[model samples]
Target: MIKNRDIVCIANTTWFGEYTKSTVQLMSRLAKNNRVLFVEYPFTWKDTLTTFLGKQKAPVSRMLGLKSRLELINTENGSKVYNLVPPPVLPVDFIKKDQLFKPFFNLNVALYKIALRKVMKKMEVKDPIVITAYNPFYGLPLIGQLNEALNVYYCYDGIGTRRHGKRIYAIDEAFSKNVDAIVTTSDYINDDKKKFNPKSYVVKNGVDFDTFYADAKNKVHKNEQKIVGYIGSLDHRFDINTVEFAVKNMPDTLYHFTGNLRNQEIKQRLDKFDNVEFFGSVKPNDVPALLATYDVGIIPYLVNDINKNIYPLKINEYMAVGVPVVMTPFADLKDFSGMVSVAENNETFVKTLITELEKDSRSAINKRIEFAKSNSWDIKAEEFGEILNKLLENGND
Candidate 1:
C-alpha cells in the first residue's frame, strides 16, 4: 500500500554482506514500489583497523560498491540500497553521569547527519519517512535535523537487560516517547512501548517461505543418529546450559549448530561434547539446504526479560522445512503451542526434544508447512505496508 514514496531506513545492522535481519528483509520488500535508502551502521576507524589486521573481513566488492561515503548495493528483490559511511568517531560503550563523552557523541552524530544529508540531496528526497530500527544513539537524534515527515522507531528487543545496554535503554525510552509511530517484534515490547507512545503496534518476526519451503524429503547430509539442530547466531541470548544439559542427557543424539559463534567461551564449552558439531556461519542462500538435514530444530534461548519477548524467525524457518521444533518457554512462542513444543526447564527441554524427534509425522509436517506459509515475509511485509499507509494518510494527527 505504501508506494512511490522515498523511505530512509536507519538500521543498527550493517548493510554489507552480513546475515539478513528483519530490517533488511522488510526494507527490501518495501523497496519494490518505493525508493529506499538503507543506511548501515557507521564504520569506525577501529573497525577499519580490525579489518586490516585480519580480525574481521571486509565485505566483497560484489556486495558493496563504495563511492566515497556512500555504498550502493543491489538487492535480489530489485530494491535500491544505499549504505552511508560515517567518518571515524570515538567509541564509548558506556556513558558517565558527568557527560564527558557528550562532545564526541555529538561529533559522531554530526558526521552521520552530514553523510545522510548528502545522500538525500543527491536523490532529491524531501520530507521522506524515516524508520529507525533500534539505533537510538545514532539515528533518533537526527529526526529533527533531517526534516523528515514522520519518524518510526522499530523495537526488536529489550536491550536494557544486557550489561552494556543500560544507557541504550534510556535512549530507547526517550525515542519511544517522541517517535511518530512505534513498531515492535513481540507483544511484551509493544505493551512496554505503548506506555510511552499509544501508536505502538506489534509486528512479529516472519520467515522467508520461498527459500525455506523446499521438499521435505531433501537431505543435505546423511546422519547415522537423529540430528537435533539450531540455525542462528550462538550469542549471549542462547542458553548454553540448556544445550549442554540436553547433549549430556541424550548422548546418542547428534546436535548440529550452523551459525556464527559469537560467544567463544560457550563455543569452547560446547566443543567438549563429542556428539555436538558446530558448522560456523553458513551462507543465507545455503540455510535451507543445511536445515533440510535437521531431524528436529531447537531454540535453546535463556529465560530472561529480554529473551522472553523475542519472536524468533528461526522457529518459522524450521517449521517451513517440515522439521519438528522444540523451543524454550519464551512468551512469544505461546501462540504457536500447537505447532511448537515449549519446554520450561532444562529437563523438560531435553524431554520435549526427544518427544518431537520421535513424533515427526507427515501430517504434523504438513500442518507446520501450512502454518509457515501463512506467516511468510511477503505476507508480513504487506501487512506492515498497510500500517505505514494508514499512518501516512492520517498525517500523524
Candidate 2:
C-alpha cells in the first residue's frame, strides 16, 4: 500500500476551475484512498501586462512575482485535496511582454530564480509526491528545491515545438532528467521523451465511460439531420480546412461542434458553412449528455510535429459515448485503424465520412463501447496509483 503524503499538482491556472479531464478523473479516483494535493495557477496572460510593458523592475513584478501558494478542494469521497499555486509567467514571457510594453517585460532570469525560491518555500511539504500534468518548463528550477519530492512528469503535449523554441526545450529537458518517472498522454510522446529520459512511460488518455455509456444507453430522440460532430477545444491544432470539407461536402448532414471557441477568426471563417452548428463550451459534467445527440465524432488535427504526437482526449470521450470517430493520420492512433476511420487528407476525410455514414455502424458503435469499457479512467487511475506507490515505497533516491 502506498502511504498518503502531500501531493501537489501543477497546471496553467486554478481559475480554469475544472481540472483537465485526465487529471480530474485520475486524481478523483486516487483521492478515494489517499490524501492528494492539486496545485492551481492563478496568474494568466493578463497578469503579464506588467511584464509585457517592459517594466520588469516594477514593484508588482518584484513583489507579486515567483510566489507559490496553496488551495484546498473538498471531494465527495471524504478525501482532502491540497492544490498548489505557482507563478504563471517566468523569464521568457517577461522578455516578450517587455518588448510589447516599455518597462513591462524587463524581467531577467535572476528574478525567476528569486521568485521560484519563494514559491518553493511555500510549496515545501514533508515527503511530497508531486504529479505535474503539464508545464515542465516551470518544474525545471524547482526540482532541486523539493527536498523529498517524488516528481511524476505528465506530458500531455510536446513542449519544445509548441511555441518558444530552444529556451523552453532546455528547461523541459532539465526537468525531465530530474523526475523520478514520466507519464505521457501518448506513446509517441513517450518515444520523444526517451531521447532525454530513459524512464519515461506512456499512459493514454481516457474518458468517463459510465457517463457516456449512460447517454449511449438512452439514445437521444432527434428528428434533425445529424451526420457528424466534434466536442473539444478549438485550438490551432485543428485543421479547419478538413472540418470545412466535411461540412461543405455533405451539405445535408448537420455538423455539430461543442466546445469553447479559442479562435474567433476560425469561428468567423466557419460561419460560412450553413450546415455547421457551434454549441459553445459545455460543462465537463454535461459532455456525455451532449454527446448523446451526435451520430459521429471527428478528430481533425493537422499532421505536424506538434499535433501528430498528441493523444486527443476527445477520441476516448467519443468512443465511450459509442459514437464512431474519424481521425487524421497520427502515429499514436494507427492501432485504431479498423475501429476508427483514418483520413490521409481532406479529400480522404470526406470519403471516409461518406463511407462510414453508409455502413451499418451498429458494430462500430459496439466496438467503440467495448474498447472504452476496458480502458476506463478507473483502470488508468489504478495504474497511475501503482506507479506513485512504487516511487514512494522504493524511495530509491
Candidate 3:
C-alpha cells in the first residue's frame, strides 16, 4: 500500500448513477488504507422539489426530473472520510449552455480553486495525495493547481468525449501537460500518452466477480424466444441501425434494453418495433439480476473515431454473468476473438445469432467465464495499489 493514507480524490461527478462500477470500485479499494476524501460537483436540490411537483401536474416531469444523488465514495475497511462539494455561490444557471459556457465554466474553476483552498485549510491537509479521474475541464486543472505531493490522472475514456470544439481541446492540452503521472483504463491511451508523458500505466477496468458471476444453480433458462439485450448508455456511440436490423431479421428474438435513453428521437423511432423493449434505467445493483434474466448480451457500437480505440467495461460484465455477447469488432474485443462473437454489420450479427442459437455450445460460454475470472476488481485494485506505491517512491522524478 502507499505510505500516504490521507489522500483527496476530486471528481466532476456527484451522482453514483453517472459513475461506472470501476470508478466506484477504485474508491472502495483506496479507502481501505487511505483516508480518502471524495469531492463531488454541485447539484440542484430545487430540481428534486420541482420534479415531485411536476409529476402530479404534468403527465411526464421531464423538465423537473429528479437530480442524481451524490454519493460519499464508501470504503471497505470501515474507516472513511468524504464530502459532497456545495454548488457555486455564484448563479451558475444564469449563463446559457453554449460555446460561451466554456469561458463561463472557467469561473466555476476559479470558484473550485477557492473551494479547494478552503476545504484543504478546514481539513488541515498539509501535503496530501491528489488523484484525478477526469481530465481537461474538471480534474486536470483542479489537481494541477493544487500542487499535491503525488498527482495521478486516470484517463478511463477517450479524450474525444469532452469536446465542444477547439476551446475544449486547448484546455485539455494545458491540463494534460501538468500531471505528474498518467494511468489509463486501456493500453491504447498508454501508448498514445508515451508522446506526452512517459510515466503512463494501463489499469484496465474489471468486474465484481462475486456479483456478476454466472449463478449456475440459479441461472434462468433462456426463453424459447431468444432475448438479445444491450445495457449501458444509449448514446451516439451505440449503433442504433445495427440494433434495428437485428430486431427486424430476428423477429422471434426479444430485443431488451435497460438504460437511460440519451436521444428521445432515437427512442421514438424504436417505438415502432413491438419486439424492442426499453426498460428505461435500472439501479447498478439491479444490473446483474437484469443480465441474468436476459438470454444474450450485445454491444451494438457504432465503430468510428470515438469508439474504435476505447475499451468498454460492459464486455467483462456481460462475460462474468455467462451471457453470450455479440459486439462490433472494436480494438478491445478484437483481442478476445474466440471469447466473444464479433459482428461487422447487421447481416453478420443476425447470421451469427442464428448460428450461436443453433449451436448453444457450453465450451464458448465457459471460455467467456474463464476469461472474465482472470479480470476481477480485486485484481485491478491490487494493480492500482502497486502503481500508487511506486509513484510515492519515484516521486514523479
Candidate 4:
C-alpha cells in the first residue's frame, strides 16, 4: 500500500461542489495512507467580481483569505485532506491569440507558484508526489519547480475537444510530455493523450459502492411512483431529444433530475412537462437515499465530441443501488457491455428503460451490487497507488 507519502493534488475541479468528481473521491481514499494537499480550482478575478456583485455564488471569502484558505477536511472512512483554496487569477479565457494568452498564462502560473510555495513551506511538505487532474495549463509550468519526486498527470477528459480546444491542446501536450506518467479514467482518453506521452495508463472510474449498496436495503420513498432519475450536472452531454422523448412517452412515470443546471434553456424546454421534476442539487451524502428512490437510472448523453471521451461514474452508482441502468451508445462502454443495457437510439433507450423498470428481479439487483462492489473507490485507489509505487520503484524519482 502507498502510505506515509506527501502527495500534492492539483485538480482542475474544486474540492467542493454539488456533485463530487471521480478525482475528489480517489484523492479522498488515497488520503487514508498519504498526507494529501488538495489544491482547488483557481477562480479568476472576474469570478470574484461576479460573486461580489451577487451575479454568481463563488467562494470569494475563502479565495481572498477573508476566511481560512487552508482547511483540514476529515473524510469518511478515516482520512484527512487539506483543502487549499487558491488565490484568484486574472481572466485569461477571453485572450484567443496564443502569443497574448501565453504571457497572461505565465503570469497566472507565477501567481499560483508563489502562493503554493508559501503553503508548502508552511505545511512542511518536501519532495511531494505531484498529480494534476485534467488542468494541463497550470500543470505545465509547475512541472519540475516543485522539486517533485514524481509528476503524474491525471487527465479525465480530452480537452482538445472542448471549447478553446486549439488553444488549450498545445499547452496540454507540453504538460503531457513533461509528466512522469499520464493516468486516465477511460481507454478513450488514454488513447488520445498517449500520442503526446506514451507513459499513460487507463485506470477507469469507480463508484462509492458501499454507501449505495447499504442504502439499497433501506426504503426511502413510500409511494409506488416508479421514478427514472439522472444524478449529474445537466450539461452539454445531455441528449435533449432522448430525454424529451422519454419524458413525453412516459407521462405516468416520474422523470427526476438532481444536479446543477448548466444551461437555462434546458429548463425552459423541459418546464412544460408535468412528469419531469428538477431537485436542483443534492449533497453527495444524500445521493444514496436519492438513488434508492430511483427505479431506474438513465444516462442520456449525445454522441458529441465531449461525450465521446467520458466514462460516466453514475452508471456504477446506479448499479450499486441495485437499479437497472439504461444509457445511449455514446462512448466506449465495452467494459460494461454485458453489465448495463445500451441503446442505439432514443426510441430504443426508452424501450430498454421500460423493460428494465418492469422486470427488475432480485437476482439482477444482487448481481449489479456485486459487480459494483469489485469496482469500488477503495479498489481503484489501490490500483492507482500500485501504479504510482511502480513508477517510484523503477527510479522515476
Model 1 residue 382 CA deviation (Å) reads 1.2
The runs of at least 3 residues in candidate 2 whose Cα sits more than 4 Å from the true structure, single-residue gaps closed, are 1-3, 13-20, 42-45, 48-70, 76-79, 86-124, 160-165, 217-224, 361-363, 393-397
What's the lDDT for residue 250 in model 4? 84
Q: What digit string (tens of lDDT, one per residue) describes model 2 on residues 1-397?
A: 3555666565533423322467767776777776666654335445566657885322233234343244466753355666544444443443443345323323332343455445546655566666767766556645655554687888877775444445577668888887888888788889888888887776777777776788773342354676588878787877888888777788988888777677776678787788877887777678787776777788888888887678777777788878778888855576565778888888999988877666635666777888888777878877787777776667735
What is the TM-score of candidate 4? Answer: 0.95
Checking candidate 3 for backbone clashes, the offending pairs are: none
* Candidate order by decreasing TM-score: 4, 1, 3, 2
Model 2: per-residue Cα lDDT at residue 56: 34
Measured against the true structure, the TM-scores of the candidates, in listed sequence, are: 0.93, 0.82, 0.85, 0.95
Give the top-scoring candidate (lDDT): 4
Candidate 3 lDDT tens digits, 309-367? 57778888888877787887656645566777898878998988777666655666666
Task: Report the candidate with higher TM-score, 1 versus 2.
Answer: 1
Q: Best by TM-score, which number?
A: 4
After superposing candidate 3 on the true structure, give the runs of residues whose Cα lies further than 4 Å from its correct spot.
18-21, 43-81, 89-103, 161-164, 214-222
Judge candidate 1 at residue 382 and give its lDDT.
Answer: 86
Model 4 per-residue lDDT tens digits across residues 228-304:
88989888878888888888988888989889999666777787899988878888899987887888888888887
Which pairs, if any, clash in model 4?
none
Residue ranges of candidate 4 with Cα displaced over 4 Å: 160-165, 217-224
Ranking by lDDT: 4, 1, 3, 2
State the C-alpha lDDT per candidate.
0.79, 0.68, 0.69, 0.86
